[model samples]
Target chain A: MSDTKRFLYVNRKAPHGTVYALESLEVVLIGAAFEQDVSLAFLDDGVFQLVKKQVTTGIGVKNFAPTYRALGDYDVKKLYVERESLAERGLTEDDLMEVTHENDDEEDVSSIEIVDRARMAQIMAAQDVVLSF
Target chain B: MKFAVVVNEGPYTHQASDTAYQFTKAALEKGHEIYRVFFYHDGVNNATRLTVPPQDERNVQKNWSELAEKNALDMVVCIAAAQRRGILDEGEAKRHGKGEGSANIAPGFRISGLGQLIEAGIQADRLVVFGD
Candidate 1:
């Protein structure tokens, strides 16, 4: 398994309305088991998945928002959030929870990055495999 | 070229699975290798053997089973998603407290983890996803 292909998971759905958001996260967690270059791109309504204080008690579904915070522990650290999507939804970076990963020095580095539309396109175009959810 | 397919929607509910089946069939017809076919989310419904579609219409589940048999395709249904949707093989049905020998999984499709999809993407030259 020496192949180390670049994989980009493009998510463009809301968190609870449908299963795409959770489905995307599930793949990201499992994909972490492989020795491949993996990155997550959140755009459109998908930005709502990273919002802080996600409570699903009223909906009777297990609130899985906390799982996003633990993704870095599995080496799935690159999570890109589009700035245009955030603005379109009337939100700012402060509305989302902070996700961080530890470096060689054991210092925690922020994993959730807010990137512009053009940079997001570049990141996606450079991938060997792009799976849209 | 080596190809991998991901079906994110169910059989008749969405055209994703049918489209994926056609694409895989066409690829094979053109002499392309199919690495695997991973079913996720509601797409797990495509692996149910108990489904009885109308005689006049196309049988989605039956179509996949026949194609897999003909092509020797590796059709995998996400274990987590299948359990959530009540689509289980013999082992899963027994472990989940169902009656004796109660199994609903179709032939040629096995219950597996999401890691299979990652492996397909890593190994295949192209990973095609058909979904809403």
Candidate 2:
């Protein structure tokens, strides 16, 4: 196997109420330094982590939702959001924050990819390391 | 195959530690290599040697220590998480000006930074995380 491995970070929980979301994001930022192929999958309640208009002011917690937008700058750009998860939660692509990364080859092309649960499972099975949080 | 396990919850209060323990044991039984078992968040509590459970209950700390000793596994408790929860090894205790007696890391477990966890992810064939 190659020394450079593909890493998939699986997010299955919500951003708040637990440390998993924020802590997982910390890991992603750190992992980016390794320069390995890193992709993030937001499923189930994890989709909430990318939801737009996240207002935590009354809750007295720093809103970390903006961090997702910064992932592109770190070269961690493959963000796969499960379609079923969003639908089940009564969410749509419009409900999530716009996570875009400037394409290296074409500066104008930038988008977040949405996949079905089956596609997500395929991606999970193909990863060299699946770090779930 | 080489595997790295991450335990994200403490003992007794959650089944995460128990599930990780069982999975590690099974992987060993199948002759798979364990690259590392990283304890993060509340999972650092599993490294404490000070836990005293009831006689009838399984000592989660003891189980992990024994398993690590038997398999020569690298059981690392995240230093950041451990320090936050008072789960210190002798070296950390002394370095931090805490008495040696304040250290509670069980045998075969080490205290390290989150870099070790990221390293485990890079090196292992599979990185499995057990959490609440």
Candidate 3:
């Protein structure tokens, strides 16, 4: 077996409309299965993947947000959200499932750290592998 | 380390391509080698040679082509996606009986199958994706 790899998974698309979100999740699971240290970052519309109270049966699609909670079981506990993305969508930590936040804004969801884009870029640069979906 | 980059979105459609490009550049700068870049789904549009965006807008096609040329990147476009989206290489155009002069395959890019992606993944240390 190969040694474990460190991976940063960045999701930048909406959850329901596009396959990117689902596919990214699949990749994350695969990476975890390979014993890789995996982290997930949701930027732009990708934050919708963590949105609580989603109802997808109307669209004939099973809501996959619940699957996100299982990521911890796979040892993928590093879930991050961009503060700006939440603000852009008029969302807050209350709107999403419990996780960690990377920023410091009360009005905004404190669930995840709100790291600035520059810091985010730096984090991405430090990663051994990055997959954007 | 070697890498297989799968780009599934077009250049101007979103930041997926730009992000992929920047990451690839960073990877190279970090003493890493890109085994291949496989463009699929909407990403096959990145290989269209006939794109001519406005001067004010960023020409993503040119950027990709330039990077590919400088690094001698192995760029592969999914043939099925290319044909379905009206992007055809010389051989494909000829086989399909299109105009004789249609050159949809951009330089530094080859239309190929998923096998190329699988091969790249097996050879590289990592398989990264910039998906739509």
Q: Which one wins by DockQ: 1 or 3? A: 1
* Candidate 3 lDDT by residue in tens digits, A80-107: 7888888899988778876533333423
User: How would you order the candidates by TM-score, starting with the best?
Assistant: 1, 2, 3
Error of 3 at B37 (Å): 4.8
Model 2, range B9-119, lDDT digits (tens) per residue?
999999999999999999999999999999998999998888999999999999999999899999998887788789988788999999758888889999887879889
Query: Which lDDT tens digits does candidate 3 get at residues B1-132?
Result: 888899888878778888888888899889899999988767989888889999998777788788899999898997766786888888899999998988677787899865565456556788888765
Model 1 lDDT tens row, A1-133: 4589999999899898888888788888888888688899999999999999999999988788999999888998899999999999999999999999998899999999999999999998899999999
The DockQ scores of all candidates, in the order shown, are 0.88, 0.61, 0.13
Write the number of the candidate with greater lDDT, choosing between 1 and 3: 1
**CA lDDT, every model vs. true structure:** 0.92, 0.89, 0.77
Backbone clash tally (model 1): 0
**Could you give the interface RMSD of candidate 1 in angstroms?**
0.7
TM-score of 2: 0.89
After superposition, the stretches of candidate 1 with alpha carbons farther than 4 Å from their true spots are none
Worst 10 residues of 1 chain B by lDDT: B93-102
Error of 2 at A7 (Å): 0.8
Clashing pairs in 1: none
Scored against the true structure, residue A99 in model 3 reaches a CA lDDT of 54
- DockQ of candidate 2 is 0.61
